[model samples]
Target: MSVHIAAQIKRVGRTLTANRAFLECITGVWLLTAATHHYIMAPASVLSQVATDLHITSGVAVWLVSAVPASWAVTNFALGVWIDRLGDYRMIALGVGTVILTGVWSWWAARQGVFSSLLGSRLVAGVAVGVIWTASVNLIGGAVSDINRATAIGVFITSAPAGFALGQLSTPVIASWIGWPASFLVMSGAAGLAFALITDSVRHLAIDPTTNTASMRANFTAVLQHRAVWYGCAMAFAAYSYYLFMNSWMPTYLGQRFALSAALSGGLAAVFPAMGVLSRVGSGLISDRLLGQRRVPVLQAAFLISLPLIVLIAWTRWLALIVTALIVAGFVIQLTFGVVYSYVREVVEADITGTALAFLTTAGISGAFSAPVITGALIEWTGAYLPAFTYAAVLTAIGLLLSWVAPESPHSMN
Candidate 1:
């Protein structure tokens, strides 16, 4: 009886410890991701202030949002081959450091009111962010068990929207308190704190270094040879294009269309990315538990459902209805994010997962880079918001088609 009781107590203690560790892991990952997002998105929240402060046109100011992704696309493509060799921990550390330094540069430029300098700093930060994104996805996907991979990643993916919401809701307030440029430095400090939280937790997640250049070449070749990767890229391109388009323009749209104050419009625009908090995690659960670990179907459904929602946003005149449409659209469209992150990792070999994700990042952020510029140009061309939103819906249709044909993972836990 004594022996049995002792064993039972030991098992209970182990369970508690495991549960605690799991919670810490989730919190650490979420916060770290959120910090990066807050830094990246802070500018979009105060674009008008930035334009006025720097004396640039709205056309030029839009590039402040676009420049990061533009450089991110190029950097992801160029640096992906080396991620496996450098390992996740080092890459993430480097990314954090780069952003911190860039933050200072941006703050100085903003104080000087140099548009070119501010823009250049954003472009440099984009390079760091690409590696950070690729490595972080690889880390999350590799950290958990196959049984819960999608669910864990789904939860992890929520950080993007959560961070976006945080930046949008907080940046204007922060700018009001300390001016727009200081928001950059403050967000970078937040990133530093977030990095500190995750540093100890993720140290064990670093990849084993590749042996040589030959191995790096092989990893790159292996990822490129996989046909499913191209399909995932197409899906990513569509999803990111739609995601960034809404995030970049919605505040401006709301301000212009409804004659809302900047604070009100920015707060309202946040509802779109905010929906990811539920959609990303829920999609992961639905795919893992309900869909039997099938990812492509979830991806397809997200795109299909989001198409009408994008149209609704374009066509609606009522503010309440537009907000409601944004809520649903944000949830539906963001389902693709967590699913694609998990899907790409599962389809590729473990050794080359980083490379596969790098490709996805490159393709997706290229869409992110393009969407704002294109939408702005379209709105300028047509002198209306309808054509811009229509362009987004068309992108969703393309993504839906791509998702329909994407190959399901052969290693499905189901």
Candidate 2:
């Protein structure tokens, strides 16, 4: 009897370890994909090339950058409903395949010198990215034990900014060396490799059980009626406002305002995201430790700190001060999501976790999508980035005000 009990404990321990390893592997793949999608294939590198080749202004080139987020937002709403039914592995495979094909198409478009075709390929790539990112987040969150869920999510979320940082740092160098078309081909190949790895590892994992009619109706009804859902959506918008603006506009701002080179601008833009990667994990760990206490205060603190930094970055002309302000703003703005996700999971039902996360992501993406256009318009109107930066600071302040109103999870309190 004693021997049997000891063996059982060992088996359980091995299973837990395997589960953790699996989650980590997926997280790594997701991070790489995100990095490639946002930084490498992102509009910034493409915008410069397309604008130069087509003799267009940066404002028009902004569409190439903005289209991906717009498509992502639309696809996420539809994809979220069907992702669980199709299975995580199937969704990943499909999403990766789509992205790979889009990369090939983008290369072809670039070679053919057809501007519209290149834009079309980007939009298609955006749709695939939307499916992959949303599914990956929900799948990883579901796979882990509740006790470790926040930590897993934190790690997963960190990959995105890490990827963005890497993308920003690498894209310009690659583009400078081989040009944009070849750079996109390399990204496509990487996506294909990630697809193969994830598909092989996830093959044996159990599929999420199909939703029944009653549960489906209940989930739809619950999400629609829940005030927490609205709050979560709002929080996502608030948290991502700064991220969108900084990631989309900051590189250009630095280049134009401070007379930095493309490589230098891209490199500097990476600092905030790199710092954000650490802050994201730290915030998650902090939230997990304080699960028994209050979550609102931590979230409130992140938002409040973000406001002053954004203001400083916008209002100050000093290069040293602007860099410092951007770094601080990046840390606080990116850190808020860790707490937001934890709060959402604690309040929402387990069955609809994907939908809940999808809604939040959609809101955030909306903010990201709209931010560039707004900033562009502001620049066109006022001929300066300060007004746009100031606008971002106001958005953060409003988000902080909303964070106070977000409902605390009853489960978290316990």
Candidate 3:
């Protein structure tokens, strides 16, 4: 009966696949990719164990988490342009297959206790993230209908925070049983599953090589010159910087600042991403359905609401208060990705979506990638959470300012 019900669902889903299946499949894969991406972040979640296992300083150990996003930022930018040229199958296969290989390499490096090798493997994994992310964005923007596009992107963008929360929520339990290397082996399997779902679905569309040189350069310049791209990238930088700090180091901060145990800190830290799952979706719905496609107000409101919460989360001593502030902060802070994504589609020419997304990815990730290492340095220098949280509040304000500079596209003129 259960199998019969499963078959029935599959049949019904196939019928719906005409409009819904591709979006839904890639969205699920996006979520899973996020889970795998954040799993590497889990080493920071248990900083002590990693330091002990590798016999490294706390500073060096943090790089295990930092390296992935940094590499992912660069790789995402390069592949964003290439996705326009090389087509989806190559990127997806390169992406999905790259992670599977690199996961094993990461596991091997971990077992061998080779720090250099581990960093190299992590770089490979980050490339997979960049390729998959670029391809997925290009796919959704170019393929999906305009009417459902915002709604689809809203749900799709939730994958990042949802995956991070799942990784934080599950890693401690799984790591306790299997050790960290074996835990990553599990992540590899998850990546493989997501790959299976999307591999056959590539549209096989790509730019002609004869048009590549001048066209790519022209597209690059055009996307860079656009005011919407500037505002989008700038705001993304601020929003993602705060998010990267939360996803990568929130547990570490909680554990140190409050002297909480790993499991306990991980549990509490898990609250941050839970709010992100709601934020992007809610902002997307409000943009599409309620606001009639104006995205700036939603973004500005997020920054405004988040500003107080950032200060509140930082200044508070009470655990409950800190957690509550984080929940609110998480919700508002995450509105940028989906809202801005939909907004970007409106402002740019249809053909260069990949390069436009690349600019946003590169710029946003530049901010996100820097946060971990910079926050680490701040903590090293100040020896407290106050500086770090204060830094975050300042970042939120910058986002608020950028929102004002960013012109509103209540309606897509394109």
Among all candidates shown, the one with the greatest lDDT: 1
- What's the candidate order when arranged by decreasing TM-score? 1, 2, 3
In what order do the candidates fall by lDDT, top score first? 1, 3, 2
Residue pairs whose backbone atoms clash in candidate 3:
none
Q: Write the per-residue lDDT of candidate 2 for residues 121-141, one digit (tens) a residue.
A: 888887888777777777776
The lDDT values for all models are: 0.81, 0.72, 0.74
Instruction: Work out candidate 1's RMSD over C-alphas.
Output: 3.0
Candidate 3: where is the Cα deviation over 4 Å? 1-17, 202-216, 247-262, 410-414
Error of 3 at 353 (Å): 0.9
Expressed as tens digits, the lDDT of each residue in 1-414 for candidate 3 is 999999999977765664455754665567556756566566765667777888898778878877777788876765666766676556766777777778888888888878888888887787777777766766665555555566667777777766665665566777688777665665578777776666545432222232233366677886777788889888888898888787667887789878999778977877787777787778888777777777888889988898888787777789888888888877888887778877775677665677778778788878988876788689889888678877777888998988987888636422
TM-score of each: 0.88, 0.88, 0.86
lDDT for predicted candidate 3 compared with the true structure: 0.74
Q: What 10-residue stretch in candidate 3 is worst by lDDT?
A: 203-212
User: Candidate 2: which stretches are off by over 4 Å?
Assistant: 2-6, 9-13, 20-24, 35-43, 54-57, 203-208, 212-219, 252-266, 290-295
